[model samples]
Target chain A: MARPVHSFVCEIGRVCSKAELKASEQPSALWVGVKAQKLPDLCLACLQAGGVFDSAFTYPSSISSHWAAVYVFCVPKLSKPVVLFSHAKQFHSVSAQIPAAVWDERKMREISGADFIGLNDLRPIIIHPESAKFVTNPLRGAHAPGRRPSARERSAGHEEPAGHGSEYGFAGTGEEGEFQIPVGPVHAGIIEPGHFRFHVGGEPIHKLEVRLSFLHRGIEDFACGRPMDGVLPLIEQVSADESVANGVAYAQAVESLASIEVPRKAESLRLILLELERIYSHLADLGGMAMDVGYYASSSRFATLRENMMRLNGRVGGSRFLRGLVVVGGMARDMPEDSLRQIRTSLRLFSDSLAKTEDLTLSSSTFIDRAFSTGRVSPEVARRLSLVGPVARASGVPCDARKHFAYGAYRSNAVRESLGQGGDVFSRFMVKLGEVKESVRLIEHQLAQDIDGPVLSERRDLSKLPSGRMALGWTEAPRGSCMFLVRSANKGALGRLAIRTASWRNWIGIQEAVRGNITADFPLINKSFNLSYAGADL
Target chain B: MHEFDALLSPKTDRIYADSPDPAIRELALFLKSRPLSPFSRSIAVRMVDCGSSNDVELEEGLTNAPQVDCERFGIHFVASPRHADVLIASGPVSVNMKLALEKTYRAMSRPKAVVAAGDGACTGGLLAGAHGVYKSGRVEEVIPVDVKVAGNPPAPYELVLGMLKAGQILSKKRI
Candidate 1:
């Protein structure tokens, strides 16, 4: 389904629904309110409307102000799209309406000392259980005995968590039919480390609980007041494969805060690299999925093709994953014509090889047998958890942040989304494959195009003191849309910056997908969904 | 012919015409530059899993999985680190894992080499200064390292290259 011409009509509809909520004149900013009472009611209406729930975070809107829990919303058809919720200013907890908002709410309450009532399962998702309790952001006049918060605080914080004061222990009755098989926070693969506790009877899995945070870099706390340029390298580490996407999201957030515009050429170059990044990332997942399902010929071919593309990328971009290529306001360098032509040729070869891989995979009966019904995520669950990207698309939820949100010249159609039906492993596979083709097509169209402009934008001179400010930037990364909220206290660099990658939001979907699946099919199911450990751990 | 044109001869076929793989071609050239050894039987290397980092553990687990029919790939992971030809370690050299790494290295026969498999192992790149992590964040700091495979966690292909590099190092070592 496509947006009807003159889609401003939907904007009008949103304004009518939330009369108190107003649309700002800024490029794309939506303003809404809690009406002092109906926080739950407003959240419920927003959740049911099928909007992409971006992230939930806490910022003291004003430096001296108490912590305000914020929920970021990406409403595709709304005039005033961004919706925020805070339990401190309004309710205790804002997660009653959103199932995926649990981790964010718990994290907010832990650090800022906010309270979130009515939130379910508020565990310390990032900090270790035994860490001591020191302020997460000592920059807000809070103090860390050391330069960084001590582990004593973080360890105890993990056990109690910010929001969850009470959590029940998990133990099952000893019976002949049940046995527990624990598989790591340190997994066996290229996969990110996250502990999985499974209750199984014979070969069938009855229950599974995931424990992540093995690679926690404390990106949010560490990012406070770091120079803008210094931030990209840190942001890029969120997910190695989706670095550019995180770069774009962070850069855009800072640009919007300062009201700076990225030059057209810079924008075009950004899209080109973003699409290239999308292709390689998806190829890794596609090949991994095929191999997971026992189609080695198809999987190995995919790997061979993937390696070739990565080498080609390293030649053109300097770094294979396109790191150090992006900066605030624009790209670090321009794409030469020879490199563009080489990329075009590389794409064609990749497309051709992809066909052979597809044929081999499609013909292999054993491959299809494992993937078809394995890790089937119900359409209802997709909606309930607000699934995104292929996970959302496969489950018959047609949401693409790039297409709908329209940022970074992606609206030009150089890159379109690969979508899928209600959430299943096959749906995720089809969505990734669709995206690969779009990436090739997008890069091809941009080959001869020229943008008349500068590559870099001027920076903000933050020497003067004033009231702290808040700004948000997001990009539709290959994994899904990643959002960043940067808030600078007049005293220094932004006191608090929250970076939420798509992996954090989609982790619950993985748990849901494995519910009915057999224990033997875990790897196949995990590969298909392919959520990130580093991204989620942050 | 121009230098660039001369570079095209090795990958003259139109098959991969878009761009030639200089890496593979260079790898081939590097091999060709050396004289062939009478040692037809390649080194049999075994990766050890001492409950180390994710990628190392995964590659270690993959040792028993049916090997891809690709040749010149004789890397096996031994159940006991004592039987391992190569102690492929990945970690920030954690205190708990330190004894294990040393035990595994000591267990390996002489002329054995150690390949540190990821940035965490090579430089303790990310996990520096953490409570659980040791003060110094390098595998070499704890143990004498032969080859370092650097990456957040090196990709599987890179891991293969690092091991092969260790194999080359192993060939030169005197028993």
Candidate 2:
């Protein structure tokens, strides 16, 4: 382990014991293994000493009867990241210290059926209580053939005895002059569904509660027992807009476990695809903010630019959403010189149009007034919630995975972390705009480098991969940092897979950001964060 | 300003189309030759995402982008199901969202058509038999679907064409 990680473990060891803490090192990060009961104390001590909680996940352990809980934390000024893990039948929760851990622990409990004691919010994060009875925990031994119930049976189980609104209950503020407003599991727009409950006094929101997991498709369970190669397609679909990032993250996990080095050419190509994905994803959020603020012209212009980029994605990778392009070892297919030329040409056009759209949007007083000073998340609150991506960056936290934990081509290429001061809607908007421009520069830089060597690694047989190995993979998704934990079973099948997307961590920040803002400003604020329901739910 | 001017007259050559498919070509020729039928010319669509990764929704949004411009052909996405002539549902219908899908379909007036807009909705695609997903993950299992647009997520023009086909079905049902 690195000195910083060793010292941090020593610090945690003082609270627990040196014998209780086990340290191991991975290529990208550090791993410190601890006993389950000591997790709460260790996490609290780490957070108190300025350690940022990156992600926490749980998986069934092959060696033990108990499940293993992994919590990744990054201590500032430390060059290497640290992942502290512990094994237990049930783990103590750290949600009281880090609010983001609430959702992580809830999801851990739901999937593994592991108890999380002292969890402030015990409400089901992914599975509805009504459907929970019928649907078997896919991670458990109940995953037998022919176990899937018929649609008729499933719907019958979900039928409420008339007058019962929903299975999950929303917490109310219980204060005078506060009325609850419930938004959709089915919204008005062409977006995925998740319910949002707001306790409001007139137009100002007092407390907001978000109920997601409406789009949960059991992705983690579906990936289990499948061969390493077959899981890429499933990972790509984890969040459509972030297909490349998720795919890269999953691939990196597999590569790290297998100790396969991605060729330099493939690394550069992967970086290009990742930056392109960032460009299109950021464009959507930028345009959505405009649409929420009624700046239709700028929004349309952004939409046009996004479409052109998606088209370019299709032309280069054979899918508009860049699906089927990233495989386990390296890339699924190589980018031809013709495609590179085309992408470069399109990028020039895209940059000019983006500048114009940014000018048009910023020039509008109505858009400016609505966006500025709205949905402000203070730096303290952002750090407490452990928010990532543009949302955290906008709040003045320099938490870019590319810059901090440089992996793949990022290890060589320079990455500039875009920062924002206000953490308001306008700040988020500017951050995204700045990121899009930065992504364009990154793509150009990658393209300027020599594109040579084999795109796909030589190791083609995934079934022959060694088993009983565990590794962590992470990439800077357009939304934020997307991390994947992979454990290979004895038969080269996925023993356990846990994914913690950026949206899953950042969704809690929205609950705090929306407070004290008017109900009408909710849409603008929500669009600024643009958290993913499917990603979070999965 | 120059970019805005160029966007006003975006070239149609880049728009996605199945020109190689004789049936679609014949249908296009037929629609072009005839006086535009009310259903064929103008239609409002309401999209519901039951349990998708949201790729379908992205493509659906892009259908209205200046390049595709399905609105020029009188296709618009309305907020309410009551105002829609076609309901385009995406994703494999999850158990949590199955009732919502049924309600949205029921809310549309009679003589309406439904388009299953992605492989997930049409046949459950990758998440066909997962534990969290509804059985088979097909939209038709929960509601009547008039058109099945198949892709991991179908391209923007493909989604538009699928809705147009559903509009054709709505016109036929009226007759």
Compute the interface RMSD for each candidate structure: 8.5, 2.5
Q: Which candidate should be chosen as best, given DockQ against the real structure?
A: 2
Given candidate 1, what's the lDDT at residue B67? 26
Best by lDDT: 2
User: What TM-score does prediction 2 earn?
Assistant: 0.93
Error of 1 at B130 (Å): 8.1
lDDT of 1 by residue, A340-397 (tens): 7888777776777677677777787887777787788877887778777777877777
Tell me the chain A TM-score of model 2. 0.93
Tens-place lDDT per residue, model 2, B29-142, is 645654546687789899999998999998888877776778876788998899988999998887778777888888888789999988899889998878778888899889
Model 2 Cα lDDT, one tens digit per residue, A1-538:
5676677667766778678878787775677788888888888877766678988887766555477788988765565556888888678888877787888877776555556777766566666765555354443453221132346644755222222234576767788978999888778888889989999999999999998888888888788889887888899878999999999999999988887878888899999999999999999999999999988888888888888788789878888888898888888888889999988888887887778888888999999999999999999999989999999999999999899878899989889999999999999999999999999999999999877999888975667777767888889999999888888976679987889899998999999999999999998999999988999887
* Native contacts present in candidate 2, fraction: 0.64
What DockQ class does candidate 1 belong to?
incorrect
Candidate 2, residue A285: how far the Cα is off, in Å: 1.0
- Taking the tens digit of each residue's C-alpha lDDT, what string does model 1 give over B1-175? 3212222121221212232644344334534453433221244454432222343543333322222221344454444545545667776654434444565577678777788877777777654444334445577866788988777545444565566567667767788
